[model samples]
Target: MSNIASILNESEPAAKPAVEAGDAPAWNSTPTTIGFGSVGRMGSGAAAEPPKDADAAAAEPTKGDASAATNSKEDGPSATVPGSAAKIASGDIPVVINEEDMEGQIYSNAAWKDLGISDEIHRGLLSENYLRPSKIQARSLPLMLSDPPKNMVAQSQSGTGKTVAFLTATLSRVDFSKPEQPQALILAPTQELADQISRNIHSIGRFVKNLKVALAIPRKIARGENVNSCIVVGTPGTVLDLGRRKQLDCSQLKVLVLDEADNMLDLNGLGDQCLRVKLRIMPPDVIESVQVLLFSATFPPKVQQWIPRFAPNANTLTLKTKELTVRGISQMFVDCPNDDSRYDILCKLYGLMTIGQSVIFVRTRKSATEIQRRMTEDGHRVTVLHGDFDSTERLELLGQFRAGETKVLVTTNVLSRGIDVASVSMVINYDIPTKPGPQGDEPDAETYLHRIGRTGRFGRIGVSISFVFDQRSFDHLNAITTHFGIDLVKLPTNDWDEAEELVKQVIKKNSAQASYVPKVDDRQTEADDSKPEPAEAASQSTTSTKKEDDKPADVGW
Candidate 1:
């Protein structure tokens, strides 16, 4: 075994290795680690002193007088431009760089000055105590701010400063003299994300004189008013309508960004609308000169194949399927008695862990409403938000959650992706996320990743507890765990006192280190061997994969 594989095997129960892609060579196997050691913390430059506050640490690192050697590699091997098969064979770069070496290659202990951003933008970053560029920002800013402006498809884990990276690119492309003209357009999959991007822009670009940003979500932009702002952020449908109506002129557009690009490009979702906006709305001249940027945390295989066509000749950065799971969050699951008893167990979770703010993800609006009502009656300040709420109401609900007015949020899939709240310390999968598959319904691994990703923001210690009350739910959770090659420590719902102490120990250990490695002995599920036949069999399966034939199958992505 390789050193990374050996390290992982020593730390947790051994999982089946991931299968390499069909066309790739032996050296291109899935990586077992992805820079878990340095996530969400400042490098050697700011190691002497800690961040003033969590919010300050969460801020995008575009400021501070720290020094590190600038990475001098140009836009040669790493940039995944079109027709580059020979480049990979020449040993210039691997499709997926080793996660250990990735930090040195991309982050490289760099300062913001290395990118040559404007003084005004630097001042805005300083106000927020941004000590240095993050991993994503360090890799992407140079390509985004290149003289001729290159197109890019960049994917990093959630809450790793993707918003700041793209926002900085958008701000740098704007011309203050053309304040009333639309110079840049940023499209998000949801209104909440667009609003969050707008807020970040105002926070990070506060020092840029005459910076005006307009939101194109419903009711925010009038029917006939021109979108007269240097930068525009909105949903695809709203932005397309304004573009077709000639209210949002794209003639002067230089940079076009699609946040959550994977979902935006999925045909079952918003892909048609996005394509129309790119091909039908924007004029051909603007299309030729406009720089296209796509950003997301998870890119499904189908979408990955189609992305190169959408953003042709673009530079690409992506992670292997094994690397998709965030290492910082400690994931566990609770074995509830039955479906009906999950509610009482859910209420008991808050007392089990030290949570700053928590989000509970249900599968439906009715469940969300019911949970909100029950939790409110139980004396918890809770908020329920989903697609059923109007745009304005949704924004207001999110605002309340971010301001700490509501310590607990019950929501459906609407808040799953790209919405960042730094204080969220825990996430409960009330109903494990699922989607329609050929076999009726299967575990939605991507949604599960995003839901838990809402916590663990910027490398903070976060915990996700999934509830499984029945055989079907247990199997679904098992499939998800196998898909990611992750071992979810089983939390016993029968004993609150024991569970609480176990949870406290997990959190304390997680907070002290960048990676989570659970011990097999301590993590084994407590099975009811006395139960008859299938129940006893199910319990045995959940405990451990000791038998040779019972190991998880290798997944090829």
Candidate 2:
């Protein structure tokens, strides 16, 4: 366990003050506050505060060699802003990009100039303090920015600058001369993600002349009004509605992006809506010239099989299964005596760790409401967000969280993907995420990855603790670990003092260990030489042989 106290006490660079509403540069018509919501602003559109290891003076080595330097900065109070890329751990972790002809190609860190980015876009990147391209950016930029545009299906772990990679491509493809003409479209599963994407585009493309971005989400675009912007970012349903109404002209669209492709393409997820937008909204003629790009952290085997048809003749860029779990986050699990005791354990965690801001993921809206109520009563600044909230309320709650008005957010899985707040240091799985299956219920490893991924952004230290009170929940968690080849350290709830010390030790040990190694133990390693694919694991039911130790009398808190 890394010393939570020490982690909290570490000094971090001073973050610039949050930019006021309507503070955006002259060229960008979208307000700076559009994506983050109307609440207490957290940070300016400037880049996120980089950790010491990601300092500008740090040297980036050639590809294929991993740098062992770890981020020494902590996600403190001032670091709660979003947008911009502090991704790839400053070249500390090496990323492997798998392509057809370029299988297992390693990419070295390169400057923005290397990509032949326009001077306007280059000035924008420099304004955001983005010095060099991340691994994904270095590899995918050329493929996306080729003479004749190319379609691409790209995957990298969360927080490795995927948003920035595609945004750069989208911006570069846009014809700025006709500012009101829609030239690019970026679709996300949720409005929150769409807003975040909008902010990033503004931050990175700040200097591009006549850059107008319109939010295709509800209330942003009036009924029957044309979506007259160079780039449109919105949810699939809203975007589809606009297109069907003939408000969003697609004849000139040069690029189409699915920010989180796995969820967008999943039959059980948002696949149908996304498919409609592709087939019905954009005519075949418009779809032909549009460069389709799909990007996400994790792409399941089933989704991967069908991605080519979605973006025909597209180049593929992916990481192996073993490299899915983020090396920056410390994964752990808590064994509780019963469901009732889980809340008590949850309350105690805030006192034990040095968390900047935390997110607790529950199974349902009722659970989220209950946790928020109980935590608020206990003197914690907490807020609850779930699907029950209307679009405006959801946006407001998220804005409050980003503004740091609420230190803890209790929510359902609606927020599990593509919401980035750099100051999120802790993520708690109040109830393990599970999807209903033919057998009964199966662990959703993809959701699990996205849930924890919220905390460990931009190579900063992050901690995830999953609570399991029964045999079934424990079994589901175990299945998830096996699926991802990750080892979750077990934390005893019987003794708070002992548990705290153990956490510190775990963090210390993991921080000291080399990067990119899955935390699988030796005993678990021999049992299965081959692991099931994500698609198979979602349907497979399995039990864990591990048993919990006897509970003891608790020491005084």
Candidate 3:
């Protein structure tokens, strides 16, 4: 077990008293001070701090992407702040998140603008409107761009520019001068994510000459079409399928990136599919020749089990801030009467967020479908997705969601991992997942974070409402809040009638929208098509419409 697990074991959920209405969770106790709960009070919560100990959620090794620094034994401390250090070590909430925003990190201040990279690559990033490299990129790029390339495992939260981090690494490493023969292979947990990554990378690297990148998503590209590229970003399913058919070969694969590895290992009902990908990797001799990179937002224990099986002693980097609460995003825990009441709450919440994007997460595919049907029947623009949907269907639904065609999305945990769509304003956990780690083959806290994080991104405030129906669900939320170092406010609900309006009010209070739903460009033409038409997204993006003779050899995403 990890250190967090051990610490959590020492204290039961019962240690903290119930939260008072509208109060933040207490991060003053032992083990309740990891992320946002302790940052400096900039707006409403903790105060900010200096950059000396930035504690970025994913701290890259300073030396390089090779190894960790050696630990030293200290004798006695008679330093400048022995008194202050003692207070922090004593588990005081005041020191939980020393939100010391360092104003002078080289990446934040200097170095990148003078990176000395080619003008074309720089233009590519600017054209894509990528303002700047995230903290992860600024710190790791220097090392990643240095010499024979290194195997790295970068752990950062969802939507934190991790995709670009490795994209930069691969772009710098891959020899665009040579034909594309799978010098690097990128694996994602789902087809839509793989598609998004492929598209984003293509757009960023558009200015780079002679770089042929092909996606391995189903129906997008067929095997043996004589495509060439130094990079291949794809879902595990498509990559494995191509390799098995001898259409795609990683014999010359120099780098293997398992983006969102935790999600693959923890995605609900995707264990078998993911395991098959590992089995399809280039044979033993070829596998030993490649450097591996694993990345995720949260690396809970269950998904960690796959480390030994996939990565070869991958170097681990973890960066976490002390303050754990996302003060900008007001969080609430509501007690529901039952399943029916929970559904009612979501319906009411949808009315309040009529102009904003929302997501409702369920525990299973069946529930996702049922809830989606009920909501759609009630005249809501919503869609449902789960492992049950084929790769094409899933990709299409994702397109609609990203395009803002559908105002709300109700689905299983499939979209929860590293799928970034910035417009999401609220996340409703209709059925809170209680498992800390996966059991049998269900997703864990690592996957759950992907769900809630879909909102409150890009400095925009958002809200997350979770319905706690039973003791198990309540305990799960308590454990999750304790781990994240956020205070949980519990609201009691009596019936479905009142629950609806209450849900709507909570959603409206956090969203920035004032009235009518935002108008977006949705090209589809169908009505019971109340759901975003997955067929339409696939039809427009794919070349199936061509008489098969005009199809191109390479189309990424």
Candidate 4:
């Protein structure tokens, strides 16, 4: 066994290893350990040692601090400790850990046993191959599962374990004795996200006796049908209508979660409906009993300031703007000769690397359809999804992508956020994400972040390639890179052989450095006099030229 694996095995009881020796090679194959020691020691009566590496150390529980380590045990299982294993094992949440608390501390990820999670739930997680908590889950789960559930405003990079973190909390809070009583509510920005979360809840809570979860998206539930499931996941508008008609009970709701909260709260339509649902649940009598949790990868400055007002006095855990981008994602740009060449360049990408599943983001439904057709002609199993599709069709298309029946998904902004597909190894930004700006249209930094975040989930390596066809597109891409302080390497389109070599090198370097700070070229000018019109104008022209296209010009999520 590897040293790290042995350390992980130390916490398991002598008689029962987490997985048998025959299965260890596949189950514990990763070179490094992530919070496994803390999990192993939970019920085996073993002591966890300090981690040897920084990542493992960050996730390991604190050690050697006698006072901090014993504080929770002395006060019983419900007392909080600043930096101690006792706090984790007792199910007490640590509020904040300052520099002083770091002395001789382990400060690693929380183990499942430390959180006092039920064995059944643990079995479900294990069955799904979730051996340990991700960074976000380790920090947020304890606080979320505490005695008096505290409101949480958590921000982590995309592909990290935000969905699982919130779902774990939701499952833990439900009272299975009354399986028909709705005890938890989860709101997502789109119907796809809601459906995805619902499926995840059912999978994770499968072993929870009598557990029931209902989806409240449009057409999924019929009119006048009451939602008596223990957990309800849906979009804001549908959930609001259900509550208004008394089909969904709010009086017994214990936890309210907002997935992709930044987008949910920023959009006018979604924001209003979300507030209405919250108001219905926060009646004067039960105001203090309900817990609110907000989660997303990015929270703009404006949204950050407004979140506290939405979830008052909430405990916050956020990443700095520079850290918002996932380091594991290798970001690069393909310099195409012109608009016509972009198609050929895009097709060549598949040959350059081994991609498990890929998503191509275009600006309009027309482009999405065209790309789907071209890619299909090139022998790719593709699915096209956009706002033009009805809810049912959209669900079916996404289901195909999730099940790996379709290897390539061509879509607009609808699939940009809160959609988790474990096998997505590459994301192609066919057109940079943009929004209507005072100066025609401009790059959308947040959407760009969320778009690429669709890949590289759960510590897997991911690649994001943007095609820059003209000076305008190049400028927009530059703005996005500058806004996020990203080091986006440029790929040469003239030579396929050379481009493949460079891409491999870039990915390898990025894995080791975890920093992409390309040196700035002071001579680069922003003179757009010779550049083509903005992408939005190009999209409009495409729509007008292809008048036979049934999709609308503004068709997008």
* Candidate with the greatest lDDT versus the true structure: 1
Per-residue lDDT tens digits of candidate 2, residues 1-557? 12321221232222222122443210111111211111111112222212122221111121221211122232421111111222221222222222121122222336677676789888877676566666667667766775456577676777667778888889988989999999899888777788778887888898898999999887789997888899999888889889999999988888999987877776555665676777667766875677899887767654543454567655545544445667778787876777888898998987543436788888877888988898888887778887777778988988888787877888777787745666677789998888768897788877888888886665556788998777677657755665555656666556779877766654444344324422111000000001111222120000111011111000000
Tell me model 3's lDDT, rounded to 2 decimals: 0.51
TM-score of each: 0.75, 0.72, 0.67, 0.72
Question: What's model 4's overall lDDT?
Answer: 0.60
Per-residue lDDT tens digits for candidate 4, residues 153-220, read: 77667766778878888888888999999889998877777777887777778788999989988878
Point out where model 2 deviates above 4 Å: 1-108, 502-557
Show the colliding residue pairs in model 2.
1-503, 1-504, 1-505, 1-506, 1-507, 1-508, 2-507, 2-508
Worst 10 residues of 4 by lDDT: 537-546
**Candidate 3 lDDT over residue span 263-333, tens digit each:** 45543333345555544457656555576776665554445444544553333344332122334455666
Candidate 4 ranges beyond 4 A from true positions: 1-94, 97-108, 280-282, 377-381, 504-557
Better of 3 and 4 by TM-score: 4
Q: In what order do the candidates fall by lDDT, top score first? A: 1, 2, 4, 3
Worst 10 residues of 3 by lDDT: 537-546
In model 3, the runs with Cα more than 4 Å from the true position are 1-107, 114-117, 223-227, 265-286, 305-310, 313-315, 320-328, 435-443, 491-557
What local distance difference test score does each model get?
Answer: 0.62, 0.62, 0.51, 0.60
The clash count for each model shown is: 0, 8, 30, 7
